[model samples]
Target: MNQDDLFIAEDNPQKQIVIVAMTGHMLLDFAGPADVFNCANRALELRGRTDGYRVLVASPNANKQVTNSAGIEITCTYSVMEVSGPIDTLLIAGSNDVQNLDDPAYQDFYHWLSAVDQHTRRVGSVCAGAFALAKAGLLNGKRATTHWDRSRQLQKNYPLIQVDPNPFYTRDGKIYTSGGVSSGIDLALALVEEDHGKEIAMQVARRLVFYLNRPGFQVQFGNLLPVYDHQNIAEKIRSWMIGHLHEPLDVVRLADHMNMSPRNFTRVFHKQTGIPPAKYVEKLRVEAARKYLEDTDSSLEEIAERCGLGGLVSMRRTFLRHLMVTPSDYRRAFRTSLADVIT
Candidate 1:
């Protein structure tokens, strides 16, 4: 037994996490969670408490060293058939060649995952692995997420799954899923907090030096670009909008500036960019407010004016809608000085 296993033995019942690794998986997806559990063990040791967690690496087959996206080799301790007892948590790490999911080993892995889900406590996926879970029907009718790029494919192939690609992570009952590779750490930390106390989870987070122990609902998709592909006209308009974010550019004037009719502009804009003009403008304005809050010593009213929200009332409302926080608190929480300025 490893140090983590020793720690787990002392707790009422050691939480067992089965990390499912595959051929050509993303190494960080698995390593990141492993590091967190290991760090939890160390944190428990400091408090003179044992029984942290039992993390086991399981593979679909035996004897082969699984290669990750970066070509690192990870050898598992057990095969899927050897997974006994209840798995308190089962995490499926993602792969680079998700297009090759039809491989025999992967097919068996999917079957094994479904069988395991019947006996396991919870099931989850990181990045593209959610597609695998969707294939196995474990994620059917469950609200789940994966790396945003694969969101469309996951939804198209598995119509039963409710795919929300925008959240950094999500939990629906016993099913948990995250947006991308590094986001797994966020999801795992959340699980740790759910199982243990907040203090221990925070301690583990601190030990891991996480950027943020992000809430599951926090937006996974960053600022969506309005310009698509190599369309210079739309790109120029987007650039102008960013520069003059504080100005109110109503639809008529904006369309006039772009040499388009209001209805025609809205259609082309949504068709090309996947968002309406008003929403695109609002997103840009909110993003500007976020930057001003983080990078400048601006008051709420000042930021409101700078972001074209008229004053504090509109700015506060916008912040609350997008960030779920008031302007003042949002600044206090996320504000930081910028190291460089654009010329």
Candidate 2:
């Protein structure tokens, strides 16, 4: 083969992927996958082979400069119209102001997506970019995922699309969807495995120092860490709640304990926490209930009392609020997952 043909062959032994970034798009979502693709290229280079992964950035206005969520700017090479030929992959990265996507830029972006649908081998969205895909009517009746924060909104707005909300990435045929920023790394690792081999993908992950390939069943990041701001009173209240799970916790009592008037406490709490005191308390209770369910051989009534639910009905409500599963079902899944980990 000639040099040009060899370049094309290496550009896509399987496919050439295009990454799309709209205005105010998330930096990490784009960067994470780009890092993986770039690392995969390095892996290919190490083997003295042709570059296997190729990525291009395209925009609606064909602007070369793209701003990130944190206001960092990145320059792009190709415009949406310039990428007219068959593309193997189309990845839409998320934006901070998702509502701003209703602008004229996105109308042009929609046309580009429609065009891509005709020739692109695979389409995917990272984070709230799923909104863009859904706007283009590409996600209907397809399994997909987006950032955990907006999964419920996506589900509410687009009932036709199945929002998994849990997986690092969901693939239904050629359409792929992934959760928020860091999950893009996992998704790209998955693609690397498919394109090359598991060993190559693992080497890429090692270069990136990634701990896990993908979380089991879309485990929400919300569950892995505490969300309270350390300097805020919400942190204090959360600490108090954790320590006093067995205590009687009510909005009035919580407000009194914080030494603020009920209304003022409620306002500040909601303003700082993005959730009401009652809801926060419920979350803490449910979290405690889950831990007990997973780690201890406690009866339902005992677990309820330990979690300070006061009654079976309250415990069930709390469990359903956080887990979307009954206490028993949650316990069963947790135990099964634990067993798998141990094995």
Candidate 3:
């Protein structure tokens, strides 16, 4: 059966979503997920149904006013201790202050989190909030992720937790963790889909003017170079590859452009970019093909040739290998969706 046909909406009860925030918390980490759930609730209400979710922001302090990392203040509806039970989902917002983990004032908050985790149906962290979860022993032996910059530190601090930095979000049993700030929206959208269906989730995404779904494990970069220390050489090569996507870009040719031997260039590129030159070139080609597929009426073979994939079959293989979908399926899913015309 086709994947699109499998996403029929079903009846779902209203769910309680509590977003925990503290002073110095990243603003988007709290607001992004809250917006997604709010949008989903609005969509449900528009369809003559009751709200699907009730979102509340909570803080650990009595003041119930938290200052974000950016110095913006937001008020919380409840103190952490006052959030009533049988929670459907509990999301912890991240902060830029790494020292928050060591603050003695948060000890009681951690203990409260541990108790809350026992009754919460689903628990999650946004961005660096994974650090708090790890400190609480909730992420032990589970695969989790946080902001790319903090992934190494999280792994170093908690050796038992598996840190995957690539994906936008991750799920292990009832716990979820998202990468960076915006990924919180992606996680919330996935939760909506899980609780309701793709139909409602898509409605929510459309209302929010966001992608219906960006798979959790999709590579974070396409035309952009991967993180690297030696950025000059990598950037030069990446720019050249993107500009010359329709040209033959074997490692030998790329190496010659850099005035280096193919072997030496390949080794250095891998060291700096964390991916082989061939794989990087393929990603560029696929990115080009994706644009053509989404925006034009070009045939598959034409797009393949234009993107320098050589043939339709080769392009299809590359899309499957990197994107986990066939070229045609991708075009169908993305092109006809609201993403095409909304923005």
Candidate 4:
């Protein structure tokens, strides 16, 4: 066995996992999958097996120190040019903004990445890292995804790639892409399942305290809402809406609060938020109900009323429409206390 990259944890490895982080990468995107593969090896050892993944991180920074988005500096010792050997997986960690690959250093890394594709079995990206992969033409004509907010920009920039915005993750042939920061975990778990088996991945998920390995199509929203920049017009109304979610939130009511006619308010709201007034109200209600379901021991009817969904039927319908899962199932999945499940 030859070493081409530095290890986070290495012992009798069967597969080599490499994560590449550019300067200013999102920390979670780099750490999440690395932990997953490391845990996979731990799980395998617990089962009295020797064949498991060896995980390492590679960076493109000169000093081998990549400062993350949170302003914390992490020293990666090995640059992209230094990485070599039988790599089973190569993951590109993401950032808020894509690095300019046209720069000479990045250009060198870009070429190295494109060259490594020949032998690397699996290639993946988390969040905005898809931009780098797409720039390399690796995702061309392939079904891929990125962070929800950046999906449109990705599509517009690279028309050759089919970008699906809804999924938490995507896998087309050898290339895999995840929606946002945390979705990297989902993708890594799926990759683990592919490499070992469902049972092994399940063990890893359980060890990581993930009750459910969320499916790719699972909607990516804790709040299921987007923040807007139109502070003068929408921020005030949005804050008010959150406080008054239990109250009636029809377009007429919202319009009255803004001191505008319903028709004019509807157009302005949609233009600013990119969602209709009625739909946005439904989103607000569903988001509230989700919190109640996850946090409290409240009954469905009580939660529905508290969230202004009116009744159980309405709440269930809204949950299905936006979340693609029922309210009860959501609680079982997202309930914070593992002790609650045991009891």
- The TM-score values for the models, in the order shown, are 0.76, 0.68, 0.65, 0.76
For 1-343, candidate 1 gives per-residue lDDT tens digits of: 3333322232356678878776777887888887888788788889887667778777756553577887777777677556655577898887767775667766666767777777777888878778778878888899999887777778998999998877878899888898888888988888888877788889888878784466334441344343356664456587788877877787887899888899998888777777778987897888888888878887888888878987788888877777667778766666673433434
Q: Could you tell me the TM-score of candidate 1? A: 0.76
**Over 4 Å off in model 2, which ranges?**
1-14, 216-219, 223-284, 288-306, 309-343
The lowest-lDDT stretch of 10 consecutive residues in candidate 4 is 1-10
What local lDDT score does residue 13 receive in model 4, on the 0 to 100 scale?
54
lDDT of 3 by residue, 259-282 (tens): 999999999888877788887888
- Tell how far residue 19 is off in model 3, in angstroms: 2.1
C-alpha lDDT of residue 316 in model 3: 82
Which segments of candidate 1 are over 4 A away from where they belong? 1-13, 23-27, 39-52, 60-63, 81-86, 100-104, 148-153, 166-168, 193-217, 232-236, 292-303, 326-343
Q: Of models 2 and 3, which has the larger TM-score?
A: 2
Candidate 2 steric clashes: 2
Clashes of each: 4, 2, 0, 0
What residue pairs are clashing in model 1? Answer: 7-51, 7-52, 8-51, 8-52
* lDDT of each residue in 1-343, candidate 2, tens digit only: 1333222343356457788887787777788888898888898889987747677766656565678878787777666566655567788887767886788756777876865777777888888888999988899999999888778789998999988877778899888888888888888888889878998899899999994364345542447234666878788777777888898887888899999989999999889877888877877888787788878778989989887887888787766656666787777767535554564
> Candidate 3: TM-score?
0.65
